[model samples]
Target chain A: MPKLDFDTINLGHGSGGKLTNQLLDSGVFSVLKNDLLDQRHDGAILELSGKTAFTTDSFVISPVFFPGGDIGELAVNGTVNDLAMCGAIPRYLSLAFILEEGLPMTEFWDILVSIRNACAAAGVSVVTGDTKVVERGKGDKVFVNTTGVGTVHPKAEIDIRRIMPGDKIIVSGQLAAHGMAIMSVREGLEFESQIVSDTQPLNHLVKDLLDEFGNNIKLLRDPTRGGVGTALNEMARDRDLGVHLEQRALPIDPQVAGACELLGLDPLYVANEGLFLAVVSGAAAGAMVGAMQRTDTGRHARIIGEFTDQHPKKVVMTSGIGGQRIVNMLIGEQLPRIC
Target chain B: MPKLDFDTINLGHGSGGKLTNQLLDSGVFSVLKNDLLDQRHDGAILELSGKTAFTTDSFVISPVFFPGGDIGELAVNGTVNDLAMCGAIPRYLSLAFILEEGLPMTEFWDILVSIRNACAAAGVSVVTGDTKVVERGKGDKVFVNTTGVGTVHPKAEIDIRRIMPGDKIIVSGQLAAHGMAIMSVREGLEFESQIVSDTQPLNHLVKDLLDEFGNNIKLLRDPTRGGVGTALNEMARDRDLGVHLEQRALPIDPQVAGACELLGLDPLYVANEGLFLAVVSGAAAGAMVGAMQRTDTGRHARIIGEFTDQHPKKVVMTSGIGGQRIVNMLIGEQLPRIC
Candidate 1:
């Protein structure tokens, strides 16, 4: 790192001048150094073959720093997971930051470190990036937009359209941790246990599951902004299929459930950063669960439900008491700017 | 398009609820509709081969709508130019939007229309996108981040490192139009002719120069945020070479020059959305200029400078008065949030 310090970012840092270079060199480039970025060109040039997955997401998560992770790691892992959801072996990412003036340099530096570590954890490189500054109050502290590109592994043929009736729907680990975690901090609720954001890089866990299941894994989606219910509901309507979810089998962290109850929110509608739902063939569902359970991030993997032909284009939830009800996707945002 | 209508975007539009689907299905989904995005999946899947270019840029240009263009086209073209600078045949783009809760639906629709036309004009597909909403005052109307991927042509060997002594520097057209245009609107200053933004897509113009010159074309850059001077200064420093620019040879529209004179700004340092610089071998300088001049976006193209070994990594300007001076990269923003 260069031996220059500014308490916070000034307009000059985004001026594309000496200060911009100074800031990038000292804070970002020093930590995320790589060959493609070192080229310092407008874009990164790479060699590739076969199918590629492309995705983009901007993290404007309020309270830039949250329990278990900050916006930095979330930005990196979010895009990486989007690509991974498509069975793409996450390889490269492009980061863009729109920072508010007067943001503490120390805060920015911490984010840079998180991004660097997250990229390493995800086995990807941030090959290109851009930064812009907005006047104070016009922007949140820092909003990150990350676009990722990755090559799809040949053995993986994942697609929602490929999902058929009788396919088992398995959710990786617990649900609602990420959303409830944000709610906890935002509402200043002190529980026996602080709810931690489930923000993590899921590429390794995905790789392991894909390796064992191969083409048997029909679909994968990280239940993020709209949570598992919203993601599954959309899939149901998009593919014109019925999904039957069992409440007893659904894995939820007791702490997250308690927090949601206090907030009068449904855990099914809360978001998750590290967890994903997988639709696997019945023949391979047991093996898929086993593979996920072997990984640290997925040790709580369970078969939550399956696709059914009874109610086409709808999702039905079975209660523990044998009662049934329609599980509606969220109608409006219960929590705004929650990532 | 769906028949539902609303005057402005409400929190529901971003709620991932019925409103979110309605807005997307009617407005965005109707205009930039394509297969990869229509899949309703988390990410787009594409097939690729050979060398590819990956780049990203976030547009926070204030006064979303301006003289020559709006933030919509700028978002598309800015990304397209980044890829074009890499000697890549621009193909696909992913657009992400962060809209404020109270933005007018009509205004958003107009920008959506502009984005569609720019994409068609540039011959690139909008394959995937994401939308998020912040509270009314938390965001400035809308901020867009576009990430693009393209296939590199076989013959082009564009690189700043390829630049060497005796190379000729050619600019695509008149400078300072973009920055000046933004300043005029923001400061509420009006010129006799109303200096419009030179915000056109330059992919075809770049392709023409590359097709004719091939590897003879050593380097390419778009003078967007920091203008021609900053772009050249960066190239000079990056390659450790001297760039000698001719003041009289520089192309500046009469109206743009007049506006600059009134504002006490140097045309050299103002931004240009549609302009680019080409460093070609001395032997092919004339041919390259001639090629650029014949194109619509490059009709005013001219030779602005040349590289020399005398002062490595410095840019010197030779005025018509036969005086010499250093042209520095902008130290601070001349105009902020001007794209």
Candidate 2:
């Protein structure tokens, strides 16, 4: 095995032969050995019941390794969050890796370990997977796509159709940490304090909300690539409700806010991987925020805004100076590949 | 609409904003206008029952377009075939695209149409999707990852445990056309007759076979990236059964064989898109072959091999010249990125 070991990925590792087996056995399977994936079949078969939630996401962040998380970690958690947003308890995930030739074996191994650890932390299994390698320079170092499958809870009726006016909107935590962290590294900025990506799995937090509220949870959404502003805008447009936010209620870490100000960016439109916005019944808003605050992942939970009948399908924010301003979805990407 | 029109995809198109909506509305949403995808939620909700098969594949095949099909077509059909191989009626797919900055909008639109057409051909809907843009050189023209979800039939009991000695092995069609098609184009070889890829969805053929033989069908698999030889080797290893292939019985197109020889390649190791191998009960083998032959996609189907207890978990090929040789999986990719 030592002599047959590869120092870096080549076309052979993806050939589905001895080399492909070596790579999987030594790197992937060695880290994430589960019954389904270890079956080594083309696909995984499971006995699932009730409604199922399916979601897919491709992670092409510039730096494969980031401040708080790498692309591998983000790939798994992001997909998990998408399923969670639909009130599904994510169970199985299929990972596909596109490895560029010449990517060092150490880096590849590192990402595989990250993926395994993330799946374990999120209480999901890496069930079935594929690996394909391209010629050098034809791709970046590595790109990962994860597709998640989970069973929807019968009591958890979550959708935008139930997003009625007067529903309370809640933000899980501080905003823009994920985006600001990437920007600082890309810009090589020397801030007084370092900003790290807030990349964490939000399924457990969403589970807590669903456990407490059952069908009262109107909707849940994760602000990833396009940030909170875009998410609210989309929810409003789709649900035919207006979102009104109080500037002072939005939670923002002073350091992250300072970094955003330094970079000429608006915090509302910057991505947050660990944070999510939820619309709940007005009667349960107080208890929802209380339950969220009790969780380790949502200590800074705040009622940032609420849905209104006025200005249907639009989002508006009240400024600190008591001025109302329309907050539209960002027409242009302030940051590309922020995911 | 003119001001909001999209000519080419830019950073904004993936920004999840006005431009993203325009691109999705004009291209993705217009073609894949299913209820789940049109819901515009973070994920698609499906009412699935019983055993579910989940599979994922990332298509990074070079030369995005080739003789018979492009990456988009392969993404859909390939996934459909994987799920079908598990005896699952391929139902829904999730498409995620990583587009390089500056990729032409026309090519993007063309690929989307191809994807939609393939989905229609396979009778599966593009339920949910995501699009992301990376800076130029960070990605190839476009890479698509399709994750397919399908439900396993009640009587369709397919598994490796059913594989045993005296079982018959069947091949769906001619081998190596896909690999040779891309190889010819990449090496700039001019052949008297062009070897086009056999890239077609085989869900209907699988359905026909399943209908004919419910639980008698032991196993089904597509011989895609690593060709038939690799696929059989995997099946043998997983099922702990010997696969005895007859060289003279393998259905290889003359042009494809000639091209493989001229290129110093063995057709056994070359990839094929629209082909599969099935192991059925000895009693039902003849009926299975007849059913496959009646289908257009499996018109060239043949009983190329059988299971034997002579050498468990090994694949041996009896050549035309009366010699037995172990047909091991390809140790290295003969044609990388052929998909």
- Top TM-score prediction, candidate number: 1
Per-residue accuracy of model 2 over B115-209 as CA lDDT, tens digit each: 98999999999988889887888788999999999988666888888887999999999999999999999999998878799999988888878
Docking class of 1: medium
Residues A10-43 of candidate 1 have per-residue lDDT tens digits of 7777776667766766644568888888535789
- DockQ list for all candidates: 0.77, 0.79
Clashes of each: 1, 0
Instruction: Give Cα distance to truth, residue B80, candidate 1, Å.
Output: 0.5
Q: What DockQ class does candidate 2 belong to?
A: medium
Local distance difference test values of all predictions, in order = 0.87, 0.87
TM-score of chain A of 2: 0.97
For the record, the alpha-carbon RMSD of candidate 1 to the native fold, in angstroms, is 1.4
Which 10 residues in a row give candidate 1 chain B its minimum summed lDDT? B1-10
List model 1 lDDT by residue over B212-312, tens digit each. 77899888899887778888888988899999999999999898898999999999888899989999999999988887788788899999999999898
